[model samples]
Target: MNADAVPGLVAVLAVTVTTIAIGTWGLRFSRTTSDFFVASRTVNPRLNASAIGGEYLSAASFLGVAGLLLVGGAEMLWYPVGWTAGYLVLLVLVAAPLRRSGAYTLPDFAEARLGSTVVRSACSLLVVGVGWLYLLPQFQGAGLTLESAIGAPRWVGPLIVGVVVLVNVMSGGMRSITFVQAFQYWLKLTALLVPAMVLLVVWLDDGRPGSPSGSDGAWSVPVAGEGAIGLYTTYSLIIALFLGTMGLPHVVVRFYTNPDGRAARRTTLVVLGLLGLFYVWPPVFAALGRVYGRELVAEGHADVLVLELPRLMMSGLGGELLTGLVTAGAFAAFLSTASGLAIAVSGVITQDVTSRFVGERGPTASVAAAFRLAAVIAVSVPVLVALLSTNIGVARSVALAFAVAASTFCPLLMLGIWWRRLTDAGALAGLAAGGLGAGGAAVLNLVGVEGSGWGAALLAQPAAWSMPLAFATMVLVSLATPSRAPSHARRFLVRLHTPEVLEQAG
Candidate 1:
């Protein structure tokens, strides 16, 4: 590696070490198995909101959003807009009732609401699938960040991040996960915010240079692929991101840390503000990249634009310092979200998979041991997949994961929380439809499937149709199988709809 890259190397090392040190501090409070899974339900609103912002931003927000905008034009703004709006949808419809359900994971909610072990098991598998899907991009982005900043081999990035994440998770569980993520949120905001401000100043200093390649209108417009397919891709991406936020496994598990429904809603409200603030900067980077870093787009290395634009537009110590800062934020992006997904996936696996085989008596010992084992499995599989796969445009790959989540869990959560007529059989059928449709499309996408006309558009962006299909299948099956509704459905709905103080008054 070049000597000039030393600052980048230091920044990456410093972030990782600081993360571990903070996790060690949080580990002190994580004594029991319950503490490990949900931070013993003591996380406050601001802290939880910061943690959510940390985990929710992922590679897509850090690097992919800017890259997509630079390459695909203004149409790409939909990605960030839908992502933030999804929280509004969650806050209005799902947040409070979900917290009130008093479930540690989605499967816990499934079993509680429907009173069926069958639905719980299915939901468990879907949670693991979605977590792994989301995790792949983080690991891939880590490799990209490390390579871009300091010239480390791509594999080293994923390996180092995987190890660090495993240590954090196995050591402190949700307590450490929460602290690390909250810290990362601010780190990422500063990393992007400072550079964006400087870049804006630098752009003004340059007397507002013209587009590097000319035809600035193309890059500023809201169209990507034109015609019918283009329209489908844009709408499907919106559906996936807007509804998908409520369905992501890592995002949903955060609610379980809130002490009450009110706190859950408050956390979500704060999260929306934090996310809205952070998202405003990516487009700035994208627009600046159009002027200063156009070659990255031409070279098909757009993911590095955020890391490269600093050095491209400036010089000497100042540029190197900004590069290091973004590199640190990028690494934090991988570490925070990867760690959050680790806890989310492992929790489900421990509850449904590993815990089933844990032979020790009592809740504490068995749950802890099982969780440790599940954490290993949860982190390992995605690391392997990320290493074996080629770059699929980090943002695009994440969108596929969102498509699957939107199709499957969006329906289940919306219906399960709001519709008393929902049955386990209905949920099971809908999950199957959504999983098969979106999962099959995702698999095809990974294997390089495409063709002319509508097939390609539908396969490329399945959420628009798949989400509605899942909802319809769930509703129709639920209508036909009204007899299969949980016996306590009314009481459960009352509990969800009622405030905690009201339950006490009753």
Candidate 2:
């Protein structure tokens, strides 16, 4: 009886065991801070690409995107497409240079490029904020999965994830996380792909080839807005997803693990392909969800659309077995993304906090210990937030996080890499403007100022306007206060733009 819950539990347990085992195995190679922070700068392009794909495909992509497509329709597909295409933007603009800078984290880039500890500390604060924002959904997704699959209480999933993640992140940092994420990538892809194939067969056998009734026509078409609010929300989302990837801390940190600029570029390209393949399935589930998952929608359970499909479509133990597989995949999404976020934020804290006391203390410092300590702090905030916050759709929460990242950090990274004249004063001012602008809007949204049309538009998509203001402030402020510019700006530019081999040989 109720084998649906049983098989689901088995699959979840199997995936969890595999993830922990891989992370433990990786600890053997992680000997020093360098290994923990950036994998000793030796991870090959192929495996690094897989790790990137795994970590990048967060709960938003796995569960949220599909749910959005089910609820909102074709406009939602752009989210995944934009997210993956962001790598191309990274490939052309910042991937190689960021990797070649030999910076383990974003703050390191700020300090090295601007030569200002003030700028570095500001960046550190932003990194921790964005990391925690990104992490809340991962923990929430975990809670949702356990509730649906195992009949567990609301808090159980997040608590389990928080403890497990703290253990993995503290054990080995980036070195260990790299292997864990790479393994989870294939597990996630397989988990989604297999159930999808079986579901497709079941749908065909049932002989309902046309569009689902409720989601047909208007709902299925691109830019087919239910109202003006939907239109503005869609366009704003497109902007946030397209521009936000460059600013994501965990995503940016992976570049530092590559051996050279060329490897970094290659890694981004492979990640694009892996992510592209994985994205194809979410829409499939979302579309079928429109048909088979109508009840979930009525019950306001859209995020669980992927989990509920098997039991709804197929009878007997086969459906339960398939639900188990999808359950495991969802867990992989949560674990891999959460682990990467913890590592990125913790690395920033460790580097920044210890730099205060030791001023680049020699190799003997307990930098690894600092990183482990920071990992605890990094994961703690989001867990608390997730527990306190009301449950929202996975995609919406993620988009809000993206809006925040796109507003604050995206401008900083773009200008830091390209605009040689940017000054420390300019950066700090821009960061303040963007953070306040976007953060204020997000807070309003949280408090439910979801007014219709333009009012809703303003709160929903603050980035398109806020990003420009931040960039303008940086340029104006930098021009107004050129005296604060770093003296070594030209030399830093050369090092950042040059190939890794050229820098080493020079």
Candidate 3:
């Protein structure tokens, strides 16, 4: 290995070992499926918040944010701002009620709320779809990180990340991950924070570099272009990031770890704080990259700017050490997020798919056996997709996943939680409308499909239209099929809204 490769390679290995060690420590507590699935609902707010931040950061937040700002200009700030704000929406609308529902996965919530196996199955499929869509970038981002940091073959990174996540997840499940992810959150924050501070010092020491646009009045605005489509794209992206957080399978599952509805809300508030603080660092990297790392933007390697910025500004051991630190954090970002998604996907598959064949054996047997089987499927599908396709910018790929979530589950959760009249027919209709409309556009965009004029903008960013359409379809269909409403809808809503303390007293 070259001299520069040593620190990065060592960093990756160290993080992998640390993650597995933390996960193994959690195995002692995971004595039951309930523990594996939800940490026995005992995770405290602070720890739970940290784990949520770790899992939610993903490659997009860690690598993609700075990269987007580096190349896409200030308009991309919405991605981070909206991502942080998404939890606020969750806090006010869904967090507490969702925790009180006692559902393990989104499908469980559907069945518990809608009282329909059909709606449950539809939710299960969408969970897997969204989970897989989200996982695609974590794996792809892993490849890009490794190839950039150590000059490894593009395929090598995904394989390593996949195997590591598989072992950590199947070893102890959610119980294990709560500790592992919490630790990763701090690790990621420090990794980004330290380098940013030092880089800012160096830039100031060299006399502040002007914005890369060279005083052309660029970097002054947060939105790109003033054309009709540009305006549409900005609003559409904002919609996706703002609404999508509540819908992410991995993110929603974290709430299930909180002990009660109140704890869930508190955890979300803490998560908002943590996310807000971490986001502050990425823009620093973007600004530094604009000044010193322009070559990467020109060559389409902007995603590695955070990893490379250390070396660009500081020479010798200082640069190498910082690179190693950032590299460890980047790897941790993938591990934490991938582990969370794998668990989310596995839980859904175990409950909805694998249980059918083995459920007669009971929750103990089915949860154990089915969970193991599901983990394999959860990690495998996305790894294959990452390998088969070309690399898109990590943040943009994540944005696509956000658009799908915003389009589908955002409507489902908002309407399902707030609206009493939601029916299985309506839920299914909305899921189909949102999933196909946004998901089709995602697939087309991924495969290099394009269109001229407004069609391209809509396809490239579908949430603006798709989310509203989903909301409308669900409402209209529910009204049309009032007879298909769950007979227990009001009681379920009551269950969701009631405080855990009050419910327990009764």
Q: Residue 86 in model 1: shift from native, Å?
A: 0.5
Off by over 4 Å in 2: 212-231, 354-365, 500-506
The number of clashing residue pairs in each candidate reads 0, 0, 1
Candidate 3 structure lDDT: 0.90
**Where is the poorest 10-residue window by lDDT in model 1?**
212-221
TM-score of each: 0.97, 0.94, 0.97
Candidate 1 Cα errors over 4 Å, as ranges: 211-223, 359-362
- Per-residue alpha-carbon lDDT of candidate 3 for residues 440-463, written as tens digits (9 for 90 to 100): 998998898989888888998899
Encode model 1's per-residue lDDT on 216-313: one tens digit a residue.
45442334466777777788888999999899999999998999999999999999999999998988898888888879988999989999999998
For model 3 the TM-score comes to 0.97
Displacement of the residue 506 alpha carbon in candidate 1, Å? 3.1
Please tell me which model should have the higher lDDT, number 2 or number 3.
Answer: 3
Alpha carbon lDDT of each predicted model: 0.90, 0.84, 0.90
Candidate 3 lDDT at 255 equals 93
